[model samples]
Target: MSEIERLDLLEKTLGRILVAIGAADAKVAQLFAISTGMLGFEATIIAEIHSFSCFTFLFLALSALPLLFSLFSLFMVLYPRLDGPESVIYFYKIARKDIDCYLKQVGGITNSELMDDYARQSHRNAEIASAKFAWLRKANMSLFFATIPWLIVVLIGYAAV
Candidate 1:
């Protein structure tokens, strides 16, 4: 594919990544809200658990692992956004005079080497972001699956009592 096409694809990919990040952020926010609400109902939960068998408490404790894992995953998802790829201005400032020379070589006088370097840098950032998203997805799944044990305990405990 042409360099332009590749760049276009990269840009599109970046856009999609941003959207995914936003959606993930929203979901995480919801999780936090729900978790916080649960906190408000903590007394009720504890009261319920108080009457249950030791097994119920054990399962309740086990449920925390997934919550922790999901939290770790949330941080992974935020890592890229928190410490984003170097900005063009930052690169320009760091590279100093090299930026001018790079710009001069643009258009018909394209500096293919410099272009490739920029592309490489973008690709690296994209890869990291994509990987983070993968972890975030896994974390989300973990968060979901974590509820199962808690539900099982609650149902069984209720039936037992």
Candidate 2:
């Protein structure tokens, strides 16, 4: 491929990685909202079951533990980790420079250097996106498991009332 075509390919790959990261972030936000709502829901249910029998309490604990774990996993997904080797394409690295310096450095880079930057950014971002997705999976699974015990707790709560 010509140098120009190779550059275009690298740009496309980087764009795809960035889009994947954006989707992962959006998923994390949605999961966060669900976790928040679940926490509020559990609080109300726990309050209603104030006179909890041992079974009720047991199920509540089971329900709560997984929910908390899911929330923690969601937090892991949202946590930012921007540390990496310096590159023109890495947001933090770029942001660390003053406007003139950033403009000069990016502007001064040759086609080959620009390709290197894009490739490094693509790899780094792919790693980040992969980790976020793994966390998202864990969060999703924990949330699902939480509902199972939570259902039992809710049913018992209703029976008690």
Candidate 3:
């Protein structure tokens, strides 16, 4: 295949990866929302339980600990990290420059340079996606752990009322 064909394929691959990142981020956000709601529900239950017994506190701690950890993990997935120097293909960096400067830089780059940039950007984005998925896994694990205690909290809460 020609270099141009290779470049096109690389560009498409990079775009697909970017879209996957966005989808993963959306999933993490949804999980964060669910965990937050669970925490709020637990807090409300704890609040309503006016008779603060040791068992009440124990169960609340058990349920809330993993929930808080899940939230933290979810937040980590959303957190932005600025690693390495910006590339010509990095839209954020490109947009920061004056229009003339951006045009000049783009006009000056050869097809080979642009392809190199795309390859580098693709690798960087892949690394970012991997990190996000790892965080997502941690968040999922913690959320699952929280549900076990949460069910107990629900039982105790219903009995108290």
Candidate 4:
């Protein structure tokens, strides 16, 4: 009805969207890890079934699928959105300002409690950002390291075959 109510609804909707994105990201990462691990097991099975030298290259190439996916996810996370860095900065600033305005309008009694609440909300936001950054960094590193050995395996397999 009011501008404040609309802003509050928008904030709530954004929060839900972010939560869904985060959940999807986690699920994707987990699936990738499981798939890669399964590929490693498959390679071991193939090595036991056939000569290690003969199939090594094929196995290596196969293992690269999950690694590539990890790199792709990392790129998605790191790529700047259409909104841009300035937009993100502005969004947070606006969010904090909105919260402050809401608190003042509500006529909170205690200064200490209001400050504490603000600090808690800020900390939560920081933690969310930190977690997202960490996930992206780890994914990138995993892909980078995995690629080298994967390439080596492909080369070795090709030479042997």
Please provide TM-scores, in order, for all candidate models, with all chains considered together: 0.60, 0.90, 0.90, 0.39
Steric clashes per prediction: 0, 0, 0, 0
lDDT by residue (tens digit), candidate 3, 1-161:
89999899889989988897897799986898889999998877766666777887787888899899999988888898556456788877887889999889988999899889889888889898889889899999999988978978877887788
Deviation of model 4 at 52, angstroms: 9.6
- lDDT (Cα) of model 3: 0.85
Instruction: Please report, in order, the local distance difference test score of every candidate based on alpha carbons.
Output: 0.59, 0.84, 0.85, 0.53
Which residue pairs in model 1 clash with each other? none
Which stretches of candidate 4 lie above 4 Å from their native place?
51-161
In the range 80-130, model 2's lDDT, one tens digit per residue, is 978877898787998899999999998899999988888888888889889
Worst 10 residues of 1 by lDDT: 81-90
lDDT of 4 by residue, 23-92 (tens): 6466556546654764575454445443465456554655566576675665565443322122222355
lDDT of 4: 0.53
Root-mean-square deviation of every model: 5.2, 1.6, 1.7, 10.5
Q: What is residue 132's positional error in candidate 3, in angstroms?
A: 1.0
Instruction: State candidate 4's TM-score.
Output: 0.39
